[model samples]
Target: MGTFVNNAWYVAAWGNEVRRELLPRTLLGQQILLYRKENGEAVALVDRCPHKLAPLSLGELKGDSVQCGYHGLTFDCSGTCIRVPGQRNIPTEAQVRAFPVMEKYNAIWVWMGDPEQADTTAIIDVPHYGDPGWGLVDGQYLHFKSNYLNITDNLVDPAHTSYVHKNTIGNAAGEEVGVKVEQSDSHVLAYRWINDAPQVPLVERMGKLAGNVDRWQYYYLHLPSISYVDFGCIPVGTEPTEANKDRGFRSFSFNFLTPETESTTHYFWLHLRNYHPDDPQASDDVARLMNQTFEEDATLLEFIQREQERTGVREYARIAIDNAPLRIRRQIERLQSKEQSAEAAAMDCEAETAIR
Candidate 1:
């Protein structure tokens, strides 16, 4: 299982999680220490100290620098060794790697690859995040015992909802409706409208509709691994347009998947809803119900992950519904291949320049 795409922005933590105290986290299989400076700027460094390879997370924060607990080796936020207590001169090789980080949309994102290529503008936009007409439930987290690709596959597959989420977001009405797939250079969209269907339980409670409605599920998987469900229902036979969706009950469920290792992921999520924008109770209900819904997914995916490992088989068969998931997989492989090729070309260029 591929751990991650290095040259992408991955959510390192919620903005509030990083403070003056050291926060240890793993992303794309790299041990990282995250903390905020006095001015509230976030910093990320290779968690291991160059001296004795001790985890710098085990050390204490001193202003904007981290003092290694083992030998009092202090390093600044730039990962440069600043002070060696016993020796007046610091070793040139005593510095650790520092990752590029940016705080935006209430989350801290880190780039673990070539720091020079870190682009803050590449971060995906969250729609209506701070709008006055929307209610938000952010800072939710879940741990998954499955490869991120598995979670991505599940996100793009709407057919499983019929059986897997019967108690929460699922119903038997749209089980046979085939999902339509579309793709762009940076994302894939799998969507279908379930027309004239009874509103699901949660929607029934929250929506103003009193009968069957034309509901839409637009499952979007952004490049690498961010997934969000644009879901809601309008009055039966209403045109399933963006304006209608906004007029009716609508919510954007955002899931930010960050790989902690080959077989595990950090699931950070939030929900935005147009209904009950002023009701705190509604927000609480949405959080509880959504958390339960995701936990259901987490449990099943863990079982699938374990079985895949046990049998050494990723898939036994592919059905018609696998189109969207397969498209995403191909996209990811292409990205990885392209990144690898770029790195190879850069290495060759460096070698030739050295010979000169």
Candidate 2:
């Protein structure tokens, strides 16, 4: 498994999931306690209590403070130990670590790295989120029994859709289409246009086109496992411009991937569409079809994960379609190295301070 970039903001749960009740979750192999204050502010903390390492989620919510059932080690939202049962003097070190958290775009995001460096601005921006004349289906979630990197690979590889998801969103028409890859500082995009072809099952059902159409599949993978798929179909021989694509039946599907463990992932997604902006039936169709499509990916990636773990190999060979996946892997390695070097330097600095 690749090293997780800890300094980034990861979605802990949907905004609705974190309420007045304490919710327990695991992110990047760490147990976390999430909840909302009485005033509606979201909060995150290490689940383990400092005294006995018991999970704080098992405790009761005393207003904004969590009172551990193990020993009544009550902690406030900032993870400061505010009260210790049967003791007038509270230990200075008796507190759980608080995680920086924020609620944005209908999700609660938590920072897993140094709290001093947490920045809410680092979170990605969702386009057309609240724009007029758009339909939104938000707060969707799924669980994947595979490494996150594997999902990242699948997200950028459109070739798999023809074989793995032929029934839902794929068709044999795109089997021969060539995919072009582009990379930037923070994202990798693998895109292609299947020109002058019959609409896939999804489009045929929703689009109701009269003749053959030109469709575009743009798979964008933002660094550290976020996916944005821009899918649409325009008229045959239509100018393939941004405005034209939007003019056609177009939708933006965003997938947020947060690692739950080395072999598990938390998948949060939202769908936005320009067509049928106010139709409840269209929202239902989008939800069902998208869920089915992602389930197909989840099933396949789980098998891939098992095989890879059994063989101790991530891949046996590389092919033409692996261009985007390979670039992401290299970029992850660079981040991993940079993090390790920073950690080592911090440790050395601590040692020097101790010597002084």
Candidate 3:
């Protein structure tokens, strides 16, 4: 019945953010200590030491293990207590919880659920990530005061772009354009197209379209918290095909949302653009404009969050655009249900085995 789902992978930090030193962070409301071993392999552990409940991050890293500053209890990367400093025999309880972590797409993902279920294949694919034709803007981060679910709501609803992101990625031209929704077991998509219109500010700057053009916005939310926006503008009547869209100005914007707490989220974003793939300046511009756009959402969402809390109402009105967001919330609840059922079954099985 909790809003947080621990059975999924969440971005703990960017790959570069983790070093050999102890870095303490909270993910899914759990205190976690992150670091790299001597071989540069990433490790994530419960930040608390079992002995005195001291934060291991306050301690020092000794070669490949963490030495508890309070009592000198040392834990290896597997969260197994290997040294007791004064005692020769280590008790079975002298251990911590080590989360399963995987490094991919320039980010570190931590799984906070059953370790046996932490399959790396569930990680979503970022197409055209390393392709020579796509410019890369990665290792970007932002902090949001609103809940992760609120951010996911904003991501699925593109109707707000007209007003919220008018200065960056949205415009008045698409205000009347209706959006379409399509969903699957793994994702929810909300998108629309603006035909034969002037390019928005982002397009005019990075796209260099001399005249009216047709543009498309395809926003995809891959459960539980990956937001991918495939947006681009092409010459009016440019066929709207995949290859032709590639020929024009297209960009893949990805937002990886990790819940720092129930009300705060860590936003890690990366961008791949088809234009000027080799230009450093292009990458910088993309980062600036994208950050500006998301900041607009962040500020607005915080206000919305405050209002929802104050009034004890998250929704005052609902319309057609609510379809995608509604679907996402339902799917999340289903996942939570499945997790509860699985845990209950496991407990029953253990009880039966003990009785036998």
lDDT per prediction?
0.91, 0.90, 0.92
Query: For residues 69-108, what per-residue lDDT tens digits would candidate 3 score against the true structure?
Result: 9989999999999999877999999999999999999899
| lDDT of the structure predicted as candidate 3 | 0.92
lDDT of 2 by residue, 160-275 (tens): 88898887778898999889999997899999989888777777777646678998899999888889999889999999899888888888999999999999999999999988
Q: How much is 86 displaced in model 1, in angstroms?
A: 1.4
Which lDDT value does model 1 have at 22? Answer: 97
Off by over 4 Å in 1: 1-3
- On residues 1-356, what C-alpha lDDT tens digit does candidate 1 reach at each position? 37478888999999999999999999999999999999999999999999899999999999999999899899999999999997799899999899999898899999988888898999988999999999999999999999999999999988888888777777889898999999998999998888898888788778677889888889999989999899899998888778988999999999999999989999999999999988999999999999988999999999999999999998999998899989998999898888889999999999999999
Question: What TM-score number comes out for model 2?
Answer: 0.98
Error (Å) of candidate 2 at residue 174 is 1.0
**lDDT preference between candidates 1 and 2, better one:** 1
Clashes of 2: 0
Model 2: pairs clashing at backbone N, Cα or C within 3 Å: none
- What does the lDDT read for residue 290 in candidate 3? 94
